[model samples]
Target: MDTALIVTVVVALTAWVFLLRSSMISMIWGPVVRSAGGDAVWAAVTSVVLYIAGLAAFALVVLAVHWALGGLPARALVLVLSALYAPVAFMPAPDRGARPYEDVRRALVRAGATEEQARACAWATGPLAFAGLAVVGGAVISVFAG
Candidate 1:
């Protein structure tokens, strides 16, 4: 119930989501957005809605975790959460030619990107990217809060 703890949880959760989920939205939903084609307004609106909804859902989860770890210090909670999520982020990257990656690349190509550009973009979406963002973000938040 401490104001400082509340503020730290909110700040750390917001930063974590911005660092992680926002990128995921673009990567996972980019194809759908591009498929809107000439309807730029529709695409933009849908993207905005998705982002808002995703943020809300993610925030709820963070709040639940915060409540569950109420007895823990903010910095330790942050580190524990980060460590728990690290396994997910550290999962081996799928092969570039794997079905999901190929599907994403193909979608991008169909959406008008060149093969090379699509390939690079698809590669960038690998979960491995989450490792650095999560660890660095958690450490930074913990330091600032502590």
Candidate 2:
């Protein structure tokens, strides 16, 4: 297999793992955190749901772009889309009374996590969700480079 293809596959796998982790955290832990009276478990759950939904959306977009472009161009299109979607992983929780990340943080703190620990946890999980796109982008570039 081409190195580019390998890179692409790796990235996609990474992204999938991140998405799965996020979903699992929300589904399994969301309720526990909420029951504990953490800030806004619902909001955090909503964000996780949204994040998963966004990944689905990106997948559809990739399929559509592939269909439209065909072959190499499809890869290019995927790269562009991935690049565009990458930043969303880092989005802060909703403010204006919307508390998703904050809710999670509150729960973590209640669970004896320090502020730094909670933030670090958020940073770790949040970015993993975007790893797939990053892989796609890397794969596209690698393929095109050859």
Candidate 3:
């Protein structure tokens, strides 16, 4: 199996999970944090841009490491990080955003926002669930590829 593929798969998946978590946080509290004049649309656009930038940075560093040292060490770092991430990725996503805000969101739920709407109110969004499958699929592909 090619190490580029392994690195690419793992790095991108890690990046995406991080992006999803950030996006969820934004959706959950973009309004409160920037209440006076926050644009959700713009906030989302910014998050995607940041994710792309970070992913590019990660790819460059990992690929450079692969070229300078060797593939095994580069892949090993990602593999270990993913192992540490397994508990978070495997566990159920928390019902609301991260804490402090979770309390506010809970209050919103009590104040009459619908279950789905209170937590996930947004103008536009990405398909995070299907996107998660891409990560899973990448892992499955890597397995079969070897």
Candidate 4:
């Protein structure tokens, strides 16, 4: 196999593993502590499986792009990936009322947060999420650029 293809596979696999591990940890620990509920072991196992499936889907998409483009254009690929994930950053804003964090906050406070507080928190988190996506995109681009 070509060095680039080998490198791509390795990078994808590493990303998949990292995501799976983190997802598993969060799923197991977060819910267990947050609500004092759910089965941590099952959560961990299920999250790992789901994350692996997500990685498979991501790999397919990347492969499709690579094939269609006839080679990786690192900058373009990074831009496309960033655009695809950009929605995630904005998603928390519109539905904060229904989100788990808001639910927890409301449970603690008699009247919950004012609309402004909720909006501020949601908007603040969006930028952090975008920064995280950018970091991931940069890592991906660097791998393929090799």
The model with the greatest TM-score is 2
lDDT of 2 by residue, 18-112 (tens): 45534444444344344534345443454456666666677677767767777878876676665555545434222233544664465455554
TM-score, structure 3 vs. true: 0.39
Assess candidate 4 and give its lDDT.
0.42
In model 2, where do residues sit more than 4 Å from their true spots? 1-39, 90-146
lDDT of each: 0.49, 0.52, 0.43, 0.42
When 2 and 3 are scored with lDDT, the better candidate is 2
State the local distance difference test value for candidate 2.
0.52
lDDT of 4 by residue, 9-88 (tens): 54664455444533332333234233323333443344334434444455556556656664447446744664444333
The TM-score values for the models, in the order shown, are 0.37, 0.43, 0.39, 0.33
Q: Is candidate 1 or candidate 2 better by TM-score?
A: 2
lDDT of 3 by residue, 87-130 (tens): 22322133354552353345334434443443343211223333
As for lDDT, the candidate ahead, 1 or 4, is 1
Q: Tell me how far the alpha carbon of residue 73 in candidate 3 is from the true structure, in angstroms, after superposition.
A: 2.2
Model 4 RMSD in angstroms: 13.3
Which residue pairs come into collision in candidate 4?
A: none
- Candidate 1 lDDT over 1-146, as tens digits, reads 46787578557655554455434434555554565564545554554455345444544545565566543564465456564443323222234564756654565556555555555554554444454444535443543453
lDDT of candidate 4 at residue 48, scale 0 to 100:
38
Candidate 1: stretches off by over 4 Å = 1-26, 72-146
User: RMSDs, each prediction?
Assistant: 11.0, 11.1, 9.3, 13.3
